[model samples]
Target: MATAPVAEAVSLDHRLGDVVVRLEFADDGPVRLVGLVSADAFDASRPPRPRVTPLVELSFAGESHVRHSHGTRHRNYAATSRLRLVERVADARRLSVTQRDPETGLVVVTTIESTTPTTVAIASHVTNEGAGPVAVEYLSSLVLGGFAEAVEADVFRRLRVHTCLMAWTAEYRWRDESLADVGLVDAGIPHPTSSTRTSYSFGALGSWSTGTHFPQGAVQDRESRQLWMWQLEHNGPWNAELDDVGRDVALSLSGPTFRQHHWSQQLLPGESFSSVRAVVAPVVGDVDDGIAALTGHRRAARAAGAVELPVIANDYMNCLMGDPSTEALLPIIERAAAVGARIFVVDAGWYADDAGWWSTVGEWRESRARFPNGLVEVTRRIRDLGMIPGLWLEPEVMGVDSSALGDLPDEAFFRRAGRPVAEQGRYHLDFRHPAVRSRLDAVVDRLVAEHGIGYFKLDYNVNIGEGTDVDASSLGAGLIGHERAYLAWLEAVRERHPGLLLENCASGGMRADPAQLGVTDLQSTSDQEDPVLNAMIACAAPSVIVPEQAAVWSYPQPHYSDDLNDFTMIQSVLTRVHLGGRLDLLSPAQLARVKAALSVHASLESFIPAAVPFWPLGLPGWQDEWLALGLRSGQRSVVAVFRRGGTATVLLPLEGRATILHPIDRGARVSEEPNGLAVTVPATPGAVVLDLIG
Candidate 1:
């Protein structure tokens, strides 16, 4: 492979046990990039899949699989990568490359989207041929340069790629791998793969083999720096494929020279195989951070191109009461001015999407029965109160009642005409069409100009569907075209509402990838209602994102239950306190308590969001009765702690004397140490404070 002559380029270094970045630009255009995966990363035990075989003439193990369209194999290859590239040929500025896996027969596809000469967008898809009953897994080792230091390497700036989280089809929460109907376990985050430094593993998902291994010393492309490994298993799956979404994206990557694993979902003969598109551009920082910086670069590019935006919010799956009535929002809007909450969000209900709010999205209408006066009145109330009203929208899907039903082409969907496509909640939108793009733009424009929605909560939690949803005749046409459509939509909206705040969701966390980082201002942690879960998320969130963007919401109750306690309630709103819990539907006294809690949070949040340089103050969360986040801004520091009681003696990590707040009574006391002060919590109460040290 010929290496491009190097000019000033992005570089990497390490900080706080992680990687840091320094991106320098190429003089003329993006630096040409490619992958050099070490053969050592591949197990000597497994065989590699075939390569660069033309998609039109696939001869898998000499067993020819004919391309079928309209119930006929009109051509030897109906949908191939060669055809996929044609979709994006017109947009040369967009990333235009794809590749395949050498082992595991998993089809690997990618696309490079460069918003700037220095920044590039990388999108990858990995699938299998549903060949032999095989288990497929993925592991991409992004080797850094020789000038990089490994000790200080850290992953910074992660954004949500997919943000929509759906309540399970049957389970109230998530399953270990798939959905299970009968269990109280929301299993909010199922462990798909156990974390290991050397080898990452994952459980079986919809179609592929489940885990990946991380080799500790596989940072190739350098002769100096030693490498470390961070193995990961798939958390679960979030498919955006509607019928053939995966196939469409795959066909666009290149020809069918991929490693694949085949399996039967049931005892029946079921297979899962895919193709991919790709491009590798030299980027800065650790791999994750590089992705974030590039995403920011792209958003900036579009902003420079004139994308108009207004900030907004929407109450979604967690805070929903299943009604979109104006009255449902009275309390939230009522408090807007006081807390300076700029936007009042009403999720799901306002639009007459399907028979209910959860399915059949994209229809735009006011449910008169739900909102008696109309959304116009609701917006008036919000504006009158000096806040903007935002609506939650799932433009990527259509329900059974969608007007576009049976009216659109088959190429827009993932399933074959009669094949079993994963149609769990609704029909996934085919963003591959310009017509669809225009309709969506119109929807946003009308909503913003007329009803006055300042924000859009775009949630896409389910997995991408297969590309077979469209007619077999138009196979693969949706490939790269689909990506262009999505980017165009975002670019247009930014040009339209350059400052509009968009909250992205993909089943909550699945969509938070680097490509969409700064494109979205606020991001969620997870759709967790439990403080235990919230505490768990808190431990990890500061490592990647700013606190303000985390979904650190806690209610006075268990979100769905009335079992409330002062300790439990405080536990709920500690991070990003929305003080939300069916607010319009809360008891009078309970509502009062919520306001009180918010008041306390108001004081603490300033510290929480700005309290950088945090350290775990004596392993606080391990106490089933306690939860805390400790921070240091300079020499001055404070630790927010709440105890569930039981003569607990918590260790203080601070060396200097500090003052502490007695969680109860909002009282304060100075510590008596040799130097100044260091405090501890009283047995049954909690504490918040101003800690000072010399």
Candidate 2:
């Protein structure tokens, strides 16, 4: 009898900075992650075993695999199939592995790139090579298993999951829970009648994918201090799940969910699909350390060359809400430029014929009624004042009464069941269509060339569920395709106009994912007008976005007191200050304070980009009485402390001599103690930024 052909196996290891990834591949077999460890861990001699786990878990065409006693079966093609190695490639920054299923003609290419020493970005590209189409119900960007030995000994009790809960007004609310709390921990053995395997799933759906839950999460081992954090870098539907499968635990992070989001992708022969990229890092420290690594990753992943983070003044928030005109904007523009704002943005209403311009937005032309002398005149005035002219444009949506609604073909807009998808009286544009991109390109080119527009605030307001099923097999696939096209258009526009600055805003901070944040120059933290309420968002935003790119609104109203004005100004100083509010309505004394704060911001701008953030008071709660966030460079550190209502004295665990830089209250005092620095504010709400020099 002839012996069976020997299985071909190969092992490869890649090192990115301090992170190491080792892969074991069997020709015409499973591809597994044999090793995933930090430099320190790899250096230490340890027993070697089969750390093999499936590289990706996928299901397609209703194929079933594992069955449970509860009468449920799950299909994971990657776990069951014998994938042949098609190609393997690597570079200084990235390692790519390609595998193909001979039976189904499905090809999967997984790539991991090191954005920083500790952070690695992961993505998967799937292609259909068969004669017929393939319907993919599930695809994962990153999946790692075989953590049983590391976590099971403590009954998986020491593993803690951390994620941020988000909403309209309140965003980035972090929630930390043990694996046992979420029912992911193994509880001894399963009874004969019941199954022990349980899955804990969480995700966000619709256009506002991160509206309810952020696509960022972390799993930390309290005993070992090993932290694994990931952020799904997509602006559309996304999901993440943690499954406890008795002997092993697995994680699946993907762009969309089939069960809840009505998402599916059909790929024809020669058609390929790419999943949303995810940034995963292994930190040996706490959450703060993880965030620092992510920050470095963000900086590394940004487009090459220096990016300017200037002070921007928008005539919105508290000043003008979609009612800008040449007469009303000239004084505000001059005042904003006088106050050290490098970019003056006439937010909203410049293209409106009437107050009901919200639904007539797609035209992108200067409103004859709003600018009788032409919008170019106002832009010229901005340039005359030595400020970059900026405009607010919602490029992704066509209003019901928009001129483009009737002019553009139906294929240019997102459609479901042969009808355009409309939400809140606006139709979402399908960036996958060349016509849609052409229209946006013309609009941007015209504005930049004719009106001298150097800045744009791209805003999205509505949440259109799932996506359109036009030329695509699945709604999620179509949505993701449009998103890719949109990013490509942005890249093209940037190439054409290298100096144009882009700001990403989705009804204020909703679509502030890494994908969008990576492309845009700045992100609006929130649309909150109340200075007191914005403190929480401002403090927590750096955890999700780079501090240098986080645009915190500093809009002091006309009726605000000196302390209130100081509070709002202090909030904006730590980040990219999007200065706004009725400076045209403030008294000279109050405006003087604003000017002083701007001066302080200008002084601090040089050091902001190099600083890494830390929360001395831990992550702030939604209604925390005292919030403290510190940024440290080399020998100097700047700390911002806000005391809302509860205490008079807050002790910060900072071990250095501190000098008050910009104190909101004259009575505020800073003293050095053996334990830490003690900051004292008034009984009422107050704010202070202290410069700690070592």
Candidate 3:
């Protein structure tokens, strides 16, 4: 008699805050993160899946997997399929699951921590305990299956993905596409299969974590109005993909892969490697709900010193343009203090003489030629004007002609094939090296102690292609190591100087990810100089970043009209304003207008930290005529609208008594309706912000 043994299946339903996760285990297979839902939608009595896959995908030596160029799953490996659950631990706020492969002695542990009621941060680590080494090609930080199980309809047609198109100067542009449109369709008709050949993926390729695309994505269920948003918290190359798994969809978020980033890791005995962190937020409503939950988590993750959200004035955007001299900065500092700016930052070109500063920037010495009495003269003046002094430092790069290059050894910089990796006349520093970190720490300490500097603008302008291949592993793996070391250095710096504020700028937000934003104080939204283009970026900034952390430029030129002044002023009134431009050259009327805008910003700054952003006109497009961003906290709401070149009138879905906050005499009118507000601007290129109380 022949008998078929029943499949061994087990499931654990864990709840953390308002979110629920279902962990599936099988005797013949690995444990899997099969389900994620809000507490309200979870049912404890539901049966578990008979078959399960690995929660952590590890592509190692002597293994083969079914994978496409864009996906990260469908691997048929005995190492993963035979893995057995070793331990499970949980609490009210966190959960940990551990599994091991007995044959190879490879262990994987996944930890999920609750950041908000609906947001959870997930990360994994792999340990090699075998006698021999294991070469890993691809490892996932987060892998979630059955993503579309809650939707009873056709998952492909009812699901939509929103991707952020990020680049230099053009950042945070969102594009929405259907799952079917991206080729993740149902291929099985009469006979169903779990394998699919297509996947929709987007990721960054180099040191610029947000260069080509932001490490952020969102999936929306059009039928049930469910939304799932996630961001991979890595400062270097990363990838995110969505593909079909049987009747459901799956998501894979990871730092680097052999296929994508040329990343591979050789793990020796008793060695462990940790993957990057990723946060997932589940909501039962639209995009706003997802953003609100993520925003709450981000605020809680910020450093203690960044709670104030102070106004900062930098002289690099459209005013001085990186040429900072004592004579040129004293007047600007006076005007900035007059306009109520809390911090004055001397941006770039402060460390070099008139000969040129790009190829000799690593020394970070105050140029006596630019400031005859040394930088102390300018910094002291900034302090005398009632503003905290700040300076820009690119700590991760060394100029080819830098004097420090001769003092530091070859191991201190990034190397490939026995030579230092150079890009744009600069050599990238390998933060993994202790010597590199020490040099940076000494530079920071010297500047802070000598110049009374309270703020540092950490700008990274160069992107070294693959990464360093100096010590061990592949180029991408080396990059991951350096990124982790860089974060550690940043944390150490913050600990040493508790009151210091660090602004993250990578040629203007090329490295603006949660990994950086979670540690830094503020992020520059863009380097876009055109006021019109900057307005569109300001409107969409809150979708990808928290409103308080998004530093939008409000640099108004002296020759601009009154309407144009309002337009530029409104660009940053709601976010952290990075004031620049020739304020010292403005006429009395223009200066008065600038002062009035700053007064409004000061009054509303308290609400900026706690407020969650929404768009009454939906997300703005690149060339959209009208753009709007709304921030709501408590019972009060603030809406900033701009008319680039469209009709003068646009209706917003809001209900309240509205009062103009800026440009009080402008021809803009706000008429309250039963459930909406009818807003009108008398002219194009006009902007306005109104306070609403219901």
Candidate 4:
């Protein structure tokens, strides 16, 4: 394949709020998504000159296309090459590009809708109209190429790929690497026939959507000062790849694929399959602007749920550590009420009769031995203390030694090869089964009605490997069904209760993708007990979730020093504070300090939901001695600065009157510099939250 002769090609251009999407139909080839430029920056003269990435890249069984690296690259599949633009429909907020493959009678409709001024939601639907069934392996949800059109600088060197590295406790860690640094470099050949041999491909493989890497990231063009951020809105296996298409770069986002997640779907005649939804934002600014656009998209796309950010005190982090009993909770409850906690969540082990709760959960019954007066007694106490009662539940898994297994049918749990799928001594419940959903619904209703529970911390602890194969095409296909069904069940629960708050926690942020976050009211940022390390997670969490929805833990232990106590408080001040610790054991001075910090946090609640995040010192490293994160709402901003023992002077590129919002008596000095504000933290382990008023 070589460069085609220069000829004028027809394109269907549609302005989607903030960007102009141009679909090129050239020389009887596939309709390609060539231009996705910002409306303000769209260049009408430079229409795409070469074959860009197709809108829908599809691969089926036994179809071959010439000049396509079938095994190496996912672009230019045979099925996609035969797809021609059949019909297109557009409205004010959406554009639907429908392509037909006459050779196989496959219809691919790529629907793009403006989620916000700078973001769009995209998904592809494939339908088979042939007489025979087609085995489908790969299909892209969204494809955007031609980064070379953004700037004149070297695309490989100037384009920065921001990849999010996630782990159990250390989640939301961002790594910025250039294409050349990631091994995808320009070969210096003119109009190469195939894609680059190597690509910067990353994805999650199991049920934990963010088990290894976050499903969202940004590609920044440093020369043009433009950024394209995207999120694969799927709860199961998903993949995203950045590869070179000739001199330009392309991004392919999709759900589970046969090659990646052992997933394949057989589409019979008159049947259709839809890919996972992906939200993308292309902005003409830096990474912060890109994130702000995505935040706006998330805010616009999600339903109107609860907006109040209440202070929740859960007995899990440094206090109860899961073994919660009436004997151990009364003092903590009093202390929580004393510290202005609006919600009191009794975490795991509340249902256990003894210490053997690990392998005997899922009954959802209050343990008589743990709560002698029944769970209602504690709920009543919580209500009397002016706090809503909540409970932690791992609803998706039944323990191996639980009595509930005798009541559930084998089909109710995830099954493969005529057996239930067990992971870490727990059987994963298939929410696709009515029995499973019904049982969980009963549990929730009973707890809410009888115990007067107002909140539920939904925690998922185990990952049932690929998926169940019971009545399904493949493992990944079954997982997709269950994932969609689980989300539906969640929405149904919310509909029924309407006022109950649901906190999403999967072993702490493993399932923190937008698909889960969109429905849940709060997202547990991490289970990391060390507040010093949690600071890194808190600052970076805004890149993934909105500040008001991110529930970062602030557990100031009684044994901690004054500086350490303030450090822990600062970790969650900018975000939703999931307050936890042995507050009952804290001295008067420590309790006063904690109360003062929470007071400051309460005062800034109105500004957080509307604010966007900015890092004055850039995204923090794991061991970065000093860290600063700011949430800006127009001219007003609140900056949380932490000194983990580096240079005392912290410089911020903004000039405003900096008043100490928290720890007013701490020895932190602020001065107006010629270029910015210079803040001096006199102590090594000091922390401060500054309110900048211009």
Backbone clashes in each candidate structure, one number apiece? Answer: 104, 0, 0, 0
TM-score of each: 0.57, 0.94, 0.96, 0.97
Q: What's the candidate order when arranged by decreasing TM-score?
A: 4, 3, 2, 1
Badly placed stretches (over 4 Å) of model 1 are 1-320, 336-340, 353-355, 404-407, 417-422, 465-488, 557-577, 584-626, 631-638, 642-647, 656-694
* lDDT of all predictions: 0.40, 0.80, 0.84, 0.86
Residue pairs in clash, model 2: none
Provide C-alpha RMSD values for all models, in order.
13.2, 3.5, 3.4, 3.1
Model 1 poorest 10 in a row by lDDT = 241-250
Which residue ranges in model 2 land beyond 4 Å of their true spot? Answer: 1-13, 24-29, 48-53, 69-93, 146-148, 190-195
Q: 98-158 in candidate 4: lDDT tens per residue?
A: 7888877988888999988888889999999888888788889888886777553388778
Q: Using alpha carbons, what is the TM-score of model 2?
A: 0.94
Top candidate by lDDT: 4
Candidate with more favorable, higher TM-score: 2 or 3: 3
TM-score, candidate number 4: 0.97
Tens digits of per-residue lDDT for model 3, 1-694:
1212224666777898999988786676678787777886666776655323357776786675543323344244446665678877788898888888788788988889898888999988899988889987877887776655655337777888988898788888888888777778877632223557567777989789999898888888877777888888889999887767666677788898787887889999999988889898888888878888888888777735335767899999899998989999988898899888989999999988874788888999988989999999999988988889999999999999887788689998889999999899999999999999988999999999999999999999988978989896898888889999999999999999988999999999799998999888889999999998988889888887898889999988888989998899889999999998898898878988988888888888778887999988888889999999999998999999999886788889999889988888889999987768989998789999989997
Q: Write the per-residue lDDT of candidate 2 for residues 1-694, one digit (tens) a residue.
A: 1112225776666787888787777765667766566665563344434543467666675764443412121224432455667776777778887877777788899888888889898888999987888788777788765444454446377778889988876888888898777776565554321235457778778888678888888888778788787899887888787765554556678887566567778888998878888888887888888888888888888945555567899988888887999889998988888778899998888888888987888999989898999998999999999999999999999898888787689888899998888899899999989888888999999999898999999999999888889887778778888887887888898899988999999988888888888778888888887888898888888888888899999987778777778888989788899998987888888888888887777788778888899899998899899998888899999988998988789889888878888754458889998889999977456788899988
